[model samples]
Target: MPPEHNAGAEHMLVSMLRPLVERGHDVQVWLSRYGKAHRAYEYRGIQVVPLQARLDFGTAARRADVLLSHLECVPSTAALARGYGKPLVVVCHNTHRPSLRDVAAGQTALAVYNSLWMEREAELFFAEYPKAIRPAESLIVRPPVFAGEYATRPGKAVTLINCNREKGGRVLEQLARRMPDAQFLAVKGAYGEQILPALPNVEIVEHVDGAEMRERVYARTRVLLMPSSYESWGRAGVEALASGIPVVAHPTPGLTESLADGGIFVDRNDIDGYEAVLRRLLGSAAEYRLVSKRAKARSAELDPAAELAAWCDAIEQL
Candidate 1:
């Protein structure tokens, strides 16, 4: 099932669905109450089902041939498959184990870490669990971005991204004050709106469709500013790179893996270091050009269709 407010999962679901439908496989989406009908309604030749029942596995399983669960929380579907002799495939979006507190209380176990970084984190957290109760068929399949419009000549526009409370809005406020000439566009909510008073350069935008978001934000963005406290895949970083733009991110756990070699990573606490890197990149056209080229190259390296095919192969093997 899809999360209520996650664009990353929406992109992944659509990416997987398109290919599966083309290959003559039936596709269905089990979504939460909050999930938008726009995507499910917009798809061509696919069955989109909204699930209203809470953990009604027997009911959901009987409607479909194979079940592809989006997150570990939906392992109830896996349990259903076990009971009904149906095939179950679970997708891992992040690698961080639920906090120790959650595990100690005997919560769900299956998960998919989007990067090698997250997979390692998960393995360490589940060290105490017996091999049998732990994630048995989890694998990393980094999220993909659909390539859309991008700036032919990126100007001084720098994107400041943070959707939730933990996304380091304070750091961005400081940067906005220092870099008065730079423009900022962020995914806005009540949590992010509070920062706008301190950040005049930043524009708060409503969550938009991925393709539209790419054209409006990613296309013109010269650098994607990722000061995230915790990011599983750095969706903004990957999207910016796919748009031929470089990223400047804090060296947070999941952000580091997503921006590796594709962009710059500054120590999270080193405010001075972050500023210096941004200034250096902006000042040097040659360095910016090189990094920009590499960013786009890296984005193209992860093919969504290819990744989904690989995931399908793994599921088939099981």
Candidate 2:
């Protein structure tokens, strides 16, 4: 998931798809709907072409057997796939109305939901548009994480991976101020303007690759914080769990579902509540160990071997 300039959702998608290359599949990812101009390049074996490139996406997509897309591009991708008379595999990452409405249009041959809650949300959307048809097949295929790759000895720093406003950058800033002596790590995300507050205790780390996260980020992290306003699925939290690092996050549907028993849930707005939880984990060694043990246990439950195999089968079946 080469994360230098990537967000969680795209990173997760790439990680889940990387194994297909090893299995001897010809995988080419096309960025068709971006307004910005960027050069095409290869990540690992996958060739990624941006919308601005001389070779148009429509020409490339025409030659390809199937089309894969998510987010804001779903509606247009559906149209393209329908027009081309090709199968569409739409990855449902969120409950955005237009995207779901587009999925209900019946052009999508396969609907890959990131979580069960998302799958249920899709059902509700189906009810909302009763006349709209459904995809032929739909399944939950969570973003896969290789536990061993992410596992590392947890450190003492309280950390938040992305310091964007919606991801609760201000919440992190307030927490740092509340606890002057406590060390905090704020990692800048690949996208968005990061809120870099002037605080002595809070250390900011520039974005790094997902391969470098274990050593560069998580190695110094004891507690992972995600105070996102919304999260489709908390991949960072799950990655933290792999290393026996306790995650303290806002009770977003994704965090609650993905973290399960591994996370320490705290409302981002409840500053007092967030402070107390942090103090307990940071102060009490026994409490930290207990939570760390739970984190490791949760990570074991989500072994990526089976999930990745299932994902590959679905992709091949498409």
Scored against the true structure, residue 147 in model 2 reaches a CA lDDT of: 90
Q: Model-by-model lDDT, in order?
A: 0.63, 0.85
Q: What lDDT tens digits, residue by residue, belong to model 2 across residues 138-224?
A: 878887888999899998799988898989899889999999999999998977789977899999898877778899999999899
Residue pairs clashing in model 2 are none
Against the true structure, candidate 2 has what lDDT? 0.85
For model 1, the superposed segments whose C-alpha errors exceed 4 Å read 1-6, 35-40, 44-46, 51-58, 99-112, 131-136, 148-155, 189-194, 316-318
Give the range where candidate 2 is weakest over 10 consecutive residues by summed lDDT.
1-10
Please give me the total number of clashing residue pairs in predicted model 1: 1
TM-score, candidate number 2: 0.94
What is the Cα-based TM-score of model 1?
0.80
Candidate 2, residue 139: the lDDT equals 76
| Best candidate according to TM-score | 2
Q: How far is 189's C-alpha from truth in model 2 (Å)?
A: 1.6
